[model samples]
Each structure stands twice: as C-alpha cells, then as structure tokens.
Target: MDEKQIIEAVKEAKEKSKKRGFNQSLEIGINLKDVKLEGADKINTSIKLPNGRGRDIEVGVFAEGDLNMKAKKYSKHVLNKEEIEEYAKDRRKMKKFAGECYGLIAQPDLMSIIGKKWGIILGPRNKMPQIMPPNKDVKEYIKDLKNTVRVKSKKNPTIHVPVGTEDMEDQKLAENIQAVYTGIERTIPVEKIANIYCKTTMGPAVKIKW
Candidate 1:
C-alpha cells in the first residue's frame, strides 16, 4: 500500500487498541524494501530509513576492497550476463545467489566496476552490484533484524522494526511506536499519508490519535 493507507491503517489500529484499554502493546514491524531507494542520500547516510524513520541500522557489508576498510568486501563469483539470463529464466538462481551472498556486501564501487567492466553482463537480470556500510555490532543487529516488527504489504519490500510490546513501558513503547509512524511518514509524505495505526502479528490494529 501507499502512504495514506499506511497512516490510516495505523490510526485505525491504534483506536481499536485504546477502546480495549490499550493494555496490549504490540511489537510492530513493516516491510519497506520495495519502497525504492530513489536517491543517493540513503547510500551516504548513517541511518537508512526509506520512510524517514530514525533508526541507526548499521549494516555489515562483505564486499571487494580492503577487508579492514569499510564493509565493501567481495567474492570471486559476482555474476555474469549469461549467468544472469539463466537465473532470470530459472528464477532459482535468485535463491542461489541469495544463498551464496551470506557474507557478501553490495559495494558502490563494485556497481561502478560492474557497469564499466561487467555491466552488460549483469544489467539485464537486474542483479546490479551493491554496497553496505559496516556495522559496529554486526552480530547483534543481524540477529535482531528479523525479530523486529515484520511489516508485510506487498512485494519483497520487507522492513522489520521494534514498535511496541505488551510488556513494554508505556512511554518507551509510545516512543518506539512513534518512530515507526514517522518512518512510514517519510516514505509516503505527510500529504499522502492520511492516517496511521498499529496491529499485532495475529490481532487487530489500534489507532494512534496523537
């Protein structure tokens, strides 16, 4: 869904929550991978929140370069044009690529090299080389990324974040929940975002009036 729907959904959900005493604080999440990276700011920013969410998510990138440098580490098998075509036809290669990408990071420099050296090789399959900044606490964030709120709307656009939980402190939960709201707001823009609310993984949503 777009921005307006996002806000409305959140608000509706929050209202429902308050009606029921708002006792249940949910650890909400949203998927925003499909939201698109439209500019160069995300690549350069310390905190990359597509929807303008203020979260300092440090990513560990294993790409080609000085291993001790940033996270721009690399592997021998990036991809080729023919191989990309094969993967497109099979679709299984995507999974294979993902599997082989366990310790790999997408480097901006690699993308440039791929374009200059092997661009024609991987352009068609949309398998462009990418880069990620190294994470200080790679292990902790990686382990908890999926555990955060899992927002699923459409496409493979997945963004998991911690919103709230039943046991969370009121102010703390509210603060976290606001972060989620602002994050979504960043994506759709305030004008487009009509409203917002929250929903449990297996329960109804509550509207946030404030």
Candidate 2:
C-alpha cells in the first residue's frame, strides 16, 4: 500500500467521522488473497508502531525472585509462581485477567509452568507471556509493549488491527497504517491484497483507492 494514499484515506476517514465523547481507535482492515489458512493460527507476531498506539497498553508479568520484584515496578499486574497456579485453576478469572492486559511477560524459568497451565487459555487468544531474558530491564520491555500491536490471522482471509487513536495527527495514523500493512504484507506471502479499509471505532470504512 502506498504511504501517501494511506494518508489521504486517513484524512478522509477523519473528516467523514462524527465527533465522539471518547477517543476512538483508528483501525485498518486488510483482505488478502490466495493465502492458505492451514496453519494460520501460528501466524502470530508483534509490530511496534512507529508513532506508538496513542493509548496505554497494560502488560501482565509472571515471574519469581528478583525479576518478579522488578516487574512490579513497571507493571500494575505482576503474578508470582503461586499466583500463576492459582489463576490456572480458575478459568473464568484467568480469562478475565488475560483480557485485561494487552500483553504478557514471564521470567524464563516460569515458561514451562505458564505453558503447561495457562497455555490452553492464553494460546488461542495470543496472550501468551513472552519469556523475559535474564538481566534485562523490565521498564524497556513494558515501554515497548505499550507501542506494540499483535497481528493474528486465524482461519480468515482478512486481518484487522488498530493503528492509532483518532485524536492523533493524520500523518502519524497514516504511518501506523502503513507500518501494519507492510508488516502483514511481509508476513503472509499472498497473491495480492484484495482491498484495504481504514476507519475509526464507530466510523464508516474509508477505502484507499490506490
């Protein structure tokens, strides 16, 4: 997709959208062609928006020892090994907690436990905790997570992801849309992009006619 075309579409979408009481997220929808969905569930990846997500992204951490302590400083929700086990027992609570956080991080040692217990819940949703490398700063990871948008295309020809918020500048939103488009284009080797649409949370879809 052309960046200039994306900007024009973004501006047109903004102008066409009516004012809302709350900030609406600018989202993009891409329709792909000739892509196999046999293993589409495995097509999961995170892309950091060049201009950020224009909103806060909460990250939940599952860790122990010093890493757990450090994670507490950066994240509001930090679960130790015991708490992880406890969450595993309550499927509803675990699902709710997983939904609350945009991303998850875990100490390397806790990977197996998280995988074995929480994998069933987190896996399908793509909310699995990332294994945190030892001796790394938790703040950096959290900061990056705030700007990251996860892309997953499971058994579907179309991919939809949030680019930014409506309050952001048009150029920034365009850049974010381009970033997601380019990232997905590189991810799924398809014949061609059938169509691309941009819109706010409650706005009409604006098609980029490039």
The lDDT for every candidate, in the order shown, is 0.42, 0.86
Tell me how far the alpha carbon of residue 82 in candidate 1 is from the true structure, in angstroms, after superposition. Answer: 16
lDDT of candidate 2 at residue 59, scale 0 to 100: 95
Task: Show the lowest summed lDDT stretch of 10 residues, model 1.
Answer: 40-49
TM-score between candidate 1 and the true structure: 0.39
> Which residue window of length 10 is worst by lDDT in model 2?
35-44
Tens digit of per-residue lDDT, candidate 1, span 1-210: 344444455555554554344444454443333244344212111222222222323323324435423222223344433444455555455545544432233444444544554344345544444444454333433334322332323333333344644444344445555555565655444443333446754457454444
lDDT of 1 at 44: 14
Which portions of model 2 show Cα errors greater than 4 Å?
A: 39-42
**Model number with the top lDDT:** 2
lDDT at residue 3 of model 2 (Cα atoms):
76
TM-score of 2: 0.90
